[model samples]
Each structure stands twice: as structure tokens, then as C-alpha cells.
Target: EDFVGHRNGAEEFVIITTLSFGPPLHDALTRRLTEELHSFYNFMERDQGYVLIEDGSGKQSQKPLMSAHITVSQGEPDPNAQPSKAASTSDDPWVDASEDQDQKPDSSKPSGSAFDW
Candidate 1:
């Protein structure tokens, strides 16, 4: 995913990778995979995302378990930004950096992550 950021010029663009996972989620094994999804792919706020479960034939059935639209930005979201009535902040899986940060200037924490589920 590539998009112009808050930067003044269109020349300044952010490029992030997106990965679509299909089939079998939220279960114990799937939870581990989800962590790897965060560890390996490393999706950011600007990135697009998708999740669908595969059928017995190993093909996606066109149903989404998660989506980029649901994963709110970790960066400064617009004050007016609000989740739709059907979706609340609690439903979002992405954790904000602010919640886990330490007061020290050099607090030990990863600079990037897809986010913890």
C-alpha cells in the first residue's frame, strides 16, 4: 500500500506491504499465526488488509473476518474520526503505541508492528 502522507508534497509517499490471510482464525493455532502476521508482514495504519476463511477445498468463500477499514490508524486520527455504530473501538485489534509506551526517552519497545491482537 502506498499513499501520500501528511507531508506537504505528493512526492512524499509511504509504502507499506499488505498480506491477506485466508481461512481458520481466532482459534489457538490461528492466534499464533495472527501474531506471526504481526511479526512478519508488519502492517501499518496506511496499509490495506483483508481476512477471509477458506472452505474445505482451500478456497476463499468471499467472507471477511477482518479488514483495513476496521483497523483504525495508530497515528493521529482526526478528532472527528469515529467508528460507525456497528463497529466500536473495542472491536479493533490494533493497539495504540501510546498505551504501551514508557516515560523514558529510550524506552525499549519495537518501532514497528502489525499490532498485537
Candidate 2:
């Protein structure tokens, strides 16, 4: 056997094989090489032994997996700027994109509250 699957930049879909079989044909050749490498990479058979593929274009190809589970996020930032003294303090109040739009919200201090984590 030789199977090899991909998709992994969070899209997740790893598979890698190299079978031979012996112990009573190793559980039917590892379940027929994980169902022929999930139908040669088309994937889509989730339940207990998960499997779901959809790399329409999001990008993902770095390989390396005996098993994996990923979930990452850290996107939004730049609502005008200035929130990174490690991420807060230092007179927070940003949003002055060169000021002068009927200026307000700086009533002397007290502004760090946008769902401040």
C-alpha cells in the first residue's frame, strides 16, 4: 500500500500510509488503506473516525501527520489602530484617523471597553 493525502492549513485532511500486512492481513490492510486514502483524497466521511475535505482554494499543503487537530484564530485588529501595549493600556483611545470628524470620545480618559476580553 502507499496512500497519501493532504490539505492542512486548518482545512485539515491528513493521511499517509505505507502498508504491508501480516497479522491476519493487518485488519484488512488497515481497512483498505483507510478506504483507499479516503477515495484518493476526495474525503467526506465523518462520524466517529472523522474525515471532511474542502480546500476549494484556501490553501494548505505542508504535510506531516500521524494525527492532528487544529483550530486557530487571531484576526481582527485595526479598528483605527493603537491597541498593543501587549494589547491594551497606554491611554488606549484610538480611532483618530487624522481627527476632525466632530471629535468626541476622549472625554479626558476611560475608553478601553470594546469587549476587552
Candidate 3:
């Protein structure tokens, strides 16, 4: 459901994504999600940057959504660096709740699509 465009007969192309959510998230979660979305959108909308919102409207069609035009500079790759994973973040209530229960994971069992955290 994603499509990228190549324009001006150049090697550079713009990336377009279609993000979907199966269910509506609560307002408490919206702030974090919206901030992350803006961060990602801004990164992609930088100099040599391109942005287009062909169909951005969604559950909140009445509200206006902002488009970004940012300039990003790529930094040299770090071999020892690691990317942050949301599931491992401190903000995850699920992880905290599970920790409170103090139940260790059953490593012997195979994981499935609808397994617990």
C-alpha cells in the first residue's frame, strides 16, 4: 500500500507511506504517537526533501493536519550504536504490568500471533 515516486528523471526518489491502525488509540497514547509521527514525517520532509498528503484525512477528518518541509543532514554511521525499540521503552505500561505480576516467560513454548507479552 506504499508507493514512492521518482521525479525530474533523477536518481533520487521520494518515499510515500500508508500507515494504518486497526483500532482507535486512547488520548493518553495519542500524544506519544502523534509526537513520534511528527518526528518521522519531519525527518522525511527535509531538504532534497519532498512531501505530499494525497489522502491524510482519517478518523478526525474535521481537524487539519500539518505537512512538513525540513532539512535533514545524515550523520556518519556508528558501528556501536543501537536503535531504540518502543517495546523496550519505559513508557510501555504493558511491560510494567507484566513485571509487577513477576511471571517469567516460558521460553520452551513457541510464540504465536496472539501470544501474551
Candidate 2: tens digits of C-alpha lDDT, residues 1-96: 533333211223333333332343456656775665555333333233443323569764433212323322334447898764442323333323
Ordered by TM-score, highest first, the candidates read: 3, 1, 2
lDDT of each: 0.36, 0.38, 0.41
State TM-scores per candidate.
Answer: 0.18, 0.17, 0.18
| Whole-model lDDT, model 3 | 0.41
Off by over 4 Å in 1: 1-26, 45-47, 50-117
| Best of the two (1, 3) by TM-score | 3
Model 2 Cα RMSD, 1 decimal: 21.8
- Higher-lDDT candidate among 2 and 3? 3
Query: Which candidate has the highest lDDT of all?
Result: 3
Better of 2 and 3 by TM-score: 3
Best by TM-score: 3
lDDT of 1 by residue, 17-68 (tens): 2332212222444567556445543354214344444767998754322312
**Candidate 3 stretches greater than 4 Å from native:** 1-25, 43-117
